[model samples]
Target: MFSHHGHGHGQYQPPATGPQHEPTFKIFCRADEGYCLTVRHDAVHWYKDMRHSTRVKDEEGHPAFALVNRATGLAVKHSLGQSHPVKLVPYNPEYQDESVLWTESKDVGHGFRCIRMVNNIYLNLDAFHGDKSHGGVHDGTTVVLWEWCKGDNQCWKILPWGPEAYAPPPPPAYGHQAYPPPPPNREPGHGYHPAPAFYPPQPPPSHDEPGYGYHPPPGGPPGAGYGNRLPRALASEPTVRILCRADEAYSLTVRNGAVCLAPTNPRDDFQHWVKDMRHSTSIKDEEGYPAFALVNKATGEAIKHSLGQSHPVRLVPYNPEYLDESVLWTESKDVGHGFRCVRMVNNIYLNFDAFHGDKDHGGVHDGTTVVLWEWCKGDNQRWKILPWFCFWRDEYCSGLILYYSTMRCSRPLPPALLPPPLPLPPLAAKAVEVVPKRSERIAAKMALEALEGPIHAVSRAQRNLMRKLGLVPERGPVTAEAIAAYNALFSKPLSQEHIIALSSLFSGSLPPGKAAEALVVCG
Candidate 1:
């Protein structure tokens, strides 16, 4: 039989037999500091100082415990499947539900332990499609069961539950000593005084004080530096370059007004693109994917899709509003290894056609033209988005050191040493009012049919509505097979009243007659 240990000793022992009678504890995932595992709205989430009970073990003789949230009184449950997410359910006092059981392993370091399910999958902080720049731990990130790979995101710390868990740790002792021997005395009525040359000298006055806070340097903003200025200056709008996944050495570059794949070069500004934050915010698509323009550093031109398959991408003058759809693209689908499919209008994607010549045998090489192509899930379609400085590390390391040094010193460089300021993009224009025309809509439908093959005109509207409701694939043509799949998913179709109610909720002003037509088509 196993024994239990008290709090603060960082030791927890589960009961070897019989029902659990141990004290409750807080569970904290090592992936995010200071946040503990909690149940919110029937879902396992990360929050501050939530308590859980882990005394009960599985009746089937497997070494596991039922994690029940103290606040919600719900037990954490993970279905015996890979696709299901971990959730919180009403506690069963009899302990009959086996899915509520979990097994905690030995400490993995820093008092964090891996909690595994009976299916051999571990409770993990979901970061499957996380951004590479950050660790990907954010507010409300879901908890899921994933195959164990020994990652810190899968390790959790068990802490004693109580008011003591919420108490802050004692601050470090500095001992008896005046902090900086007091700042040197200055002349009367003089508010500013120079600090000493030693490390971490007296800090400047706060922004509220007269003559303090961050003031723009003579040449540019606070963070801007000379020499290698692009990366440091545009910190708000990060500088990133697109690298072809099929050929890692080749990057998307603008050469002679056309987009092409060329060998990665640090000095070549054509390969560097700034992800336009302003346009991304204003011109996002209906699906919530941010459609941003990739602006080339050297030419100040944006990569524009010319519309239609096999059409060469061109570098056009930047349009802040993204009034033209050709200049907008979205990175919605992750394709592994920090790469994603850069999707354009409809189902077209940015592709490096390595098989352009000799369709059966051509291979990816330098100078290959980048063009628009229908989605085929090929490696040539995946592109890695990386910071421009990452590609020019060898050349900009010294500039980075100088930048950090200035940041530490808290002194602005002399005006003579500063580089010329870069021009900022014009503010986005007011959104253009769109007047829908039947002729234009028909033309667009015809274009889509040419690319993806034709669908029946009779049920087109119903199929499109079902696609929006996630009953069918959004990009493909509505075929008989697709209709059958939709029917299989929904055995009982909604009535005319239900369709009208849904339409009113979504569009608020959709006519009832149109909603009734939708129901008939759905039937």
Candidate 2:
């Protein structure tokens, strides 16, 4: 038995065989959510975060996040009960999603980024599996070190810190460990269990364990005088932003007795900096008139030296053409975001079903063209997708993804997100079918009478679905079937929205998740 020597504060470990250095791990990852897993004891532990429940069917805290060891189909998820560590034996890997974003690399100096939007709080690569926004960057950039990217193996192994690192994670009270005070009367043969009487005596907390009930991150600046304010017990985690000044690579961690780096000069790029008139710090310009000035904290004056000679202020880019398409359409303003023009569509904008020469870049008007590039704004290139799809759907609501096959390869739209909400919906029913307004009743009558036009594939699918859903009687033309189906579908005077949700069967641009909402259940 041993204890710390003098003031050295060294941890004395007796001989037992498990890896010595403690490590950190991420347990769960989702794009919109932040923290998923943290290293506690020798094992990784997980707890549900608010952002996660919105994306998946989280039944309870029971199954916090999925973990699996490749060699075994199921890996036991180890947890801490009130006292001892309890192991929930083997869980299926297929049901659980796992990614070794940071591998145990041999590359010592190599850096790793925290996937904030998905896993940790620094960098995010991919949010959705099926969508284009896989990583923060689209051109196949792995934002962090992963085994898949074929980088040096060291990319995965991140060294937590130096010798004087954050204090060690609390020791696990294994099932075999004994409690304090031994026992009131030690029966010669029997040992103590974690019963009410055998509760392990807790050691007095050290300076590392903030005795004050304070959230350290928000507890003003580090080393600030919190002399009066202290928590009964410090936070279990204290987040630190780690940055490699050499590589500008960064990772953030809740320094929970684990050594991680610190962040560098972090700045928000959305601010505008205007110059001053005299160029002296003394002559200040109050820039909060039309917009607030991004000023230096030391001097509450204009950002640049002087204003006279064309001080290029950094204002947020308002280029409608450069903005995300959905945002542009909603705000009805062109922030000069990018939009590509195709000769086929003779326009610059995106449309999943927009028929054209199907080509790009100055092709002839054969409407059978090829070649596509990123969209940008020119009059010929000035574009926006129609915000309303057939009046009943949320247009462009991640509708950019089209599972189209020019050959056998399905081309997915870039910067698109995966089909969230599970099993992407089948295309909405009935909505795609062109319907005559009440004013066009005569036209509808004429169309029914003619019956000469080629039926579109979507329209045909609508007919089939209607028949399948028992909306129409068997063995009849689509118009007749439609009439019967419409009568059966509604009791109230249904609007187009209600009719489509109830009777839609068209297989066009439906988001995969809404397949059930748009389902036309067949007989």
lDDT of 1 by residue, 1-523 (tens): 0011112221122213333333456666666655555554212211121122243332222355566653345666553233335665555444233345566676678887777653233333333322234555555555766656666667777665564533343332477321121134522112112212321112223432211222332554434232222323343465676876576666777665667777766556667788776656655543457766677765556665543346566555554532444466777657664567676522233343433522244646667887766567667777766665431143243343233223223255676754344321111010011212211111111111111223333234444445654444567555423333333333343344444444542464656445534544555
Q: lDDT of each prediction vs. the true structure?
A: 0.47, 0.23
lDDT of 2 at 338: 22
lDDT of 2 by residue, 381-412 (tens): 22222111111123332221121111111333
Q: TM-scores, in order shown?
A: 0.31, 0.19
- Best-fitting candidate, measured by lDDT? 1
Question: Per-prediction RMSD in angstroms?
Answer: 28.2, 28.3
For candidate 2, report its TM-score: 0.19
By summed lDDT, the worst window of 10 consecutive residues in model 2 runs over 323-332
Which prediction has the highest TM-score against the true structure? 1
Listed per model in order, the count of residue pairs whose N, CA or C atoms clash below 3 Å is 0, 60
RMSD of 2: 28.3
